[model samples]
Target: MPTELRPLGVTCNIQCHYCYQNAQREAGNMGGNYDISKMLQTVDQVGMEFTLFGGEPLLLPLEDLERIWAWGKERFGKNSVQTNGTLITKEHIDLFKKYNVTVGISIDGDGELNDVRWCGNLEKTRTATSKTMSNIELLCESGIYPGIIVTLHRFNASKSRLPRLLLWLECLDELELKSCRVHLLEVETPMQRQLLALTADENIQSLLELYRLERELHHLKFDIFQEMRALLLGLDNKTTCIWNACDPMTTRAVQGVEGDGTMSNCGRVNKDGVDFSKASEQGYERYIGLYYASQEKNGCNGCRFFLMCKGQCPGTAIDNDWRNRSEQCSIWMRLFEEIESDLITQGYNPLSQHAVRAILERYLVQEWTKGANPNLLRLFLHSSATSYEREVMHAYLVENNISHKWSQGKLAHLDHHWEGE
Candidate 1:
């Protein structure tokens, strides 16, 4: 969990089309009158890792940035920030080490891939990307390796372009960049909706292939892949922040604070001066209840992945007109299939448990009808029914009213029910 502080609100130098906070900036809502002492007090009250965030947090005056960094380190013992990497300096790098600030730079990739994030003009964007990469190298030279955040878009998700993007990341890995967060482009604005070219299926397939390549190459690591792997190994609760006792309505796992010292839901919704936590209480709960119930009633009640996906990001779900699922549902489903198959290959049969089997029959099998892989089907069939398994299977069959008659010996005949797979 982190306390996300927006010191200057949405005032950034670069105009990234996909940025969700652009509306606030356009509305002249850049925060600058924040009372630092009170903000620090609120951050202390939260007692979590502090994150300095904004249109570009580094754009804040050097003294103010240093003061916030000092306070965060003194009170919370660690601090971090996400910046565009265009404004960083040698002095900032020094302060980063002094205050234990973990820097996360937002860059899509090298050249035109990154120039999509405009810097007022095409020529400026080209110049900025070069300087941004230079600053990244400087950070590495000073023994401070920064994490990269790549916001995936249609252009970057193409089969040819995706591998090239990976190669660029591999070069960064050589420069000692160790981590990256690969985010799917969220169509939050008209610009995003128009510019985003990749479909849900295309993005998922590209990302899944990227995961496999990363595994084979053993170079850089993606945060999403790590989380997925953690889920597969049953270490999800221990390793993943979002998976641990997260009641979305009440859980302030990531609290977004405004410049005027107001606490809000998160950065995306809060930049508009909305106190998201207070405003969304009833709305969030209602949406959650209705959405989950509908999913269960429709079939998800039987999905083992339900608990893991948890219907994806509630915000993203709402952004897509409260569709009862994440827009990235295709990506998540593919990821789970890969992870589950990997676990089986490693001799862990997730379906051996009656609980898993019961859930699988409800929706996992049916959902696979559209894109069932032959090899995965074999993995699903590999579980040998023990005496205990026989009892569980028989009970599941009767509870679901799956009419196939089953005795102790012909349990494997259940394959007939799963025809398309």
Candidate 2:
């Protein structure tokens, strides 16, 4: 099913250094008025799952939220809100239950780790966080699962810091957290670059340490940590990693509605080439039409994982010099290889084989199903498919008469059938 993320362009109370929203912390007002009636009508027209995100969505008045929930329930069945958790109150919790809103809270970790950007008032954050914990408990008690979004920064990557974060989560009394998502801070703009810059060595070391701990916590009950562990252990290859940008299942069907109510293919690209204010003056549909018309001509044509990534976050692509592969791709590949080597050294033959098969199967499925465009497929196959087992794979394909082609750079197609399948 397609999912639509509607950015409310609202301001927030806290000033997080790494926030991508560019929200005004003091004014705490949305960029433009959010017309609930028009928004609901659009949701009904699209018939897609909707998510509310903002400078801080909770900053919106509770009555506005209630109206949203009522209209949303009549049109879209499920909805979610991503928030920083500082503004949650008992009334907010009740509204959540009334709307059946799935909650995702953004918190780095323990007081120390979380204090990195939650810097306005240490005592207030502590108080707010404690209250948020209670809210989470209330949600869980009410049978609503809540997820945590943790952003890893320079300090949180330290060997000592990671363990402490884990311990903190274990300590929370009401934290039956359903998931914990960890993401590296992406610094793209010059202003952002100045605000958040990490040395390459620091980044590498942090990733390595994170991967090590991830391996140690593989069987955790929560979803995020388990997924990270699986990724570290090489269990979450392209096939199993549902969030792999290449996987169609993980792709988000987003419509970017800007401050002035103009729509775009993706909100991430709202800052680029889109004149939302003008479009809003004209009509929302005009902007959407322009966006759809420009979609085919944009990025993802020559990408190796075009089928999988499908030009992820146009804003991210533009910000990162239009590179096809994301920064996380290299880290993931390195971690996978490291785990594979460790498995071999430990004499875990079956586990190592399974890891290898997972990687290969994903490659096979992508190439065979025409999931990846030919040029990208050729590069991946040529660079990685160079082993005795790979030769065996080619032989199997030939024997089975699979209607697939091999990369001409390294391996050539067999003229006749081979002995093995």
Candidate 3:
């Protein structure tokens, strides 16, 4: 996971109505008054180049950014930052080029579609967006090629607004922007849900359409769908942390660094407040509890896809409650279904093949209680697992050797023997 350094914490220039950081800001977890020395010390101790992240990382002073970037360039070949794009200027672009910094911009859509990213009122919001658009254009003109991040909500990606969203993406494609990370709305409050969140049906249709759009576009790729297909292909490398059974407490998904050089959990899981040594510590409960949970009791049991989905991201958990499975559960399932069918039609041997699916599912749920996302491929290849772990976790062990279908029953019904039985 990439470590993120936040100089300004959750403080942003414009208030997006559905932003996850709002709760942190509300609880007075605002960032500022950071020490450059201490922040550098923390990163050096970790011994890696870090991504400058934020409420809006550009809110940091240019000299401060240059200082950090210079230090980063001296130590590591490259640096990175994920920003809202509104605050980026020509000087900032020059600094970015000097240090070889990779930039990522966050925008929902343009004009009326971006109303959810409210800057006090509609006119101000549009003006802010116009600045962001100009900055994006400037970055492209300067040969920056920043990756685009879009948060899908009713304001931007609803059934009615999707065409406009596509048109905007087409414009980005024309600009030669290649990579886009699309996030489903993280509905944190009742009001946001009602006003901005897409219905489950809407979310499903929007992404399916976007996937088709990706096929036709010369540039512009959605990271999520690509990651999903990668997971099915038994390729665990280079996928997002969400798919790998993220532990809510540890939240190793993204290593977040604070303004004062303290490490923090992923902001999505820190819904109530930004807790650290200053705040009380919470227990490691959610993901572990999921291990023994049964689908019959309204949880992720007997779901063959659990190995790949890992209950999705805990941040998107139902009601913003990490203990519960993701609220977008239905959407993930439908997308996985679509992708798996397509891969099968192409004669690709996806890990989710029915012949070995049940065994892997059964094995993964058992392994979950141990508090980790074990790689199914590693076990399949090396024959290095303990007796039981290697039993049916490998597809060949179950399909090539076993006499019965895993769906028929448990290990008792299809013990690891050749087809002779």
Candidate 4:
């Protein structure tokens, strides 16, 4: 199901160093407030499944959460919550069972890794992580399986750290935890400055190696990195990774409500001067309209990775490097190139598998012999089939000196013949 995330602007107990939300304080109450009833009405109108998130969503008074969950049950039939896990109590577990809410706990890795941010006293962070694990266990005992969202950073992406994490989780296998998800930290803000500034090649190598190891691990049932690797390598023949950010299908299509009730495009975009609470009251349509308008105005269409990126978090786009793709995209694309190069070396032709290599070869030979425009040649190659097919075709065309574009009439005729055949 397509998921929508609603941020409840409630304060979090722990102060993480790299928190994307400027959740530190309520400066003059500028963050604003959201009416839960209005928010629920909007969710109903959108007809999409919703997930509750927050500066720390669990900080929402349990009664408020219950009301939201009940309202959600009445409308969407299923709801979920993403929390830092410190606030989870037996009462929270009971409410989760009553509402059938799926829970996702945000814990980076082990004590050492988690303490990097979940930071206060090292011992306290470890204690909280252990308690959170217990909370996950309690929820599971109640038949509410919880997933862990681990943020990958310079510290946790180590080869040694990943194996340790997997082993630790395996040790906790009796708890019946749902699965663990990992996300690369994006270097888009001051909060991430330290992580971003650490440009050590060793760190990058460790992360890549860890990812490779994670893929080869047999005991783990769920590894997002594996899925990401497959998607990047074009291994998942049926699933196209060219997601439009504005499409409901895009995972990046998220709404973050801050503790102050102000809405931003996503967690990263919830920075200053991007309030949506007023328009949000007008409902989902208005909110989406604003988002799309901002996207277009920002010239995201011109991006090479536009189809895949969909202009991640306009607030981040505006505040930081507006033109930068998500850090995840960079990692994914790098892995994709590596896998594609490896496959090519191994005699696997992605185009041949897609059944377009022959057509592409013919086109490339003809175009090169005729001295066609490189741009036109590329446009034609792209038109012949899928993006991956187009990419392979372009590689062949470039190798043969075929132009990547076409003259208007010639391209039209060629396109007709290609489509007809």
Best by lDDT: 3
* Higher-lDDT candidate of 2 and 4: 4
Q: Candidate 3: which pairs clash? A: none
Give me the displacement of residue 343 in model 3, in angstroms: 0.7
- Compared with the true structure, all predictions reach lDDT values of 0.65, 0.50, 0.77, 0.52
- Model 1, 69-183: lDDT tens digits are 9988888787899999999988899899999999999999888888668899989998999989999999989888899999888667677688778788778878867788888
A best-first ranking of the candidates according to their TM-score comes to 3, 1, 4, 2
Q: Please list the residue runs of candidate 4 whose C-alpha ends up more than 4 Å from where it truly belongs after superposition.
A: 1-7, 23-34, 158-163, 172-178, 189-191, 195-206, 215-223, 226-252, 257-263, 270-273, 276-319, 326-330, 341-348, 351-421
Q: What TM-scores do the predictions have?
A: 0.78, 0.62, 0.88, 0.65
Better of 1 and 3 by lDDT: 3
lDDT of 2 by residue, 359-380 (tens): 4434534443443422222322
* Per-residue lDDT value at 44 in model 3: 87
Q: Count the backbone clashes (under 3 Å) in each candidate.
A: 2, 3, 0, 17
- Candidate 2 segments exceeding 4 Å error: 1-7, 23-30, 119-127, 172-174, 189-252, 258-261, 265-319, 339-421
In model 1, how large is the Cα lDDT of residue 9?
73
Q: Could you list the CA RMSD of all candidates, in the order they appear?
A: 9.8, 10.2, 6.5, 10.2
lDDT of 4 by residue, 203-235 (tens): 455456655654455443345444433332222
Winner on lDDT between 1 and 2 is 1
In terms of lDDT, the poorest run of 10 residues in model 4 is 412-421
- Say which prediction, candidate 1 or candidate 3, comes out ahead on TM-score: 3
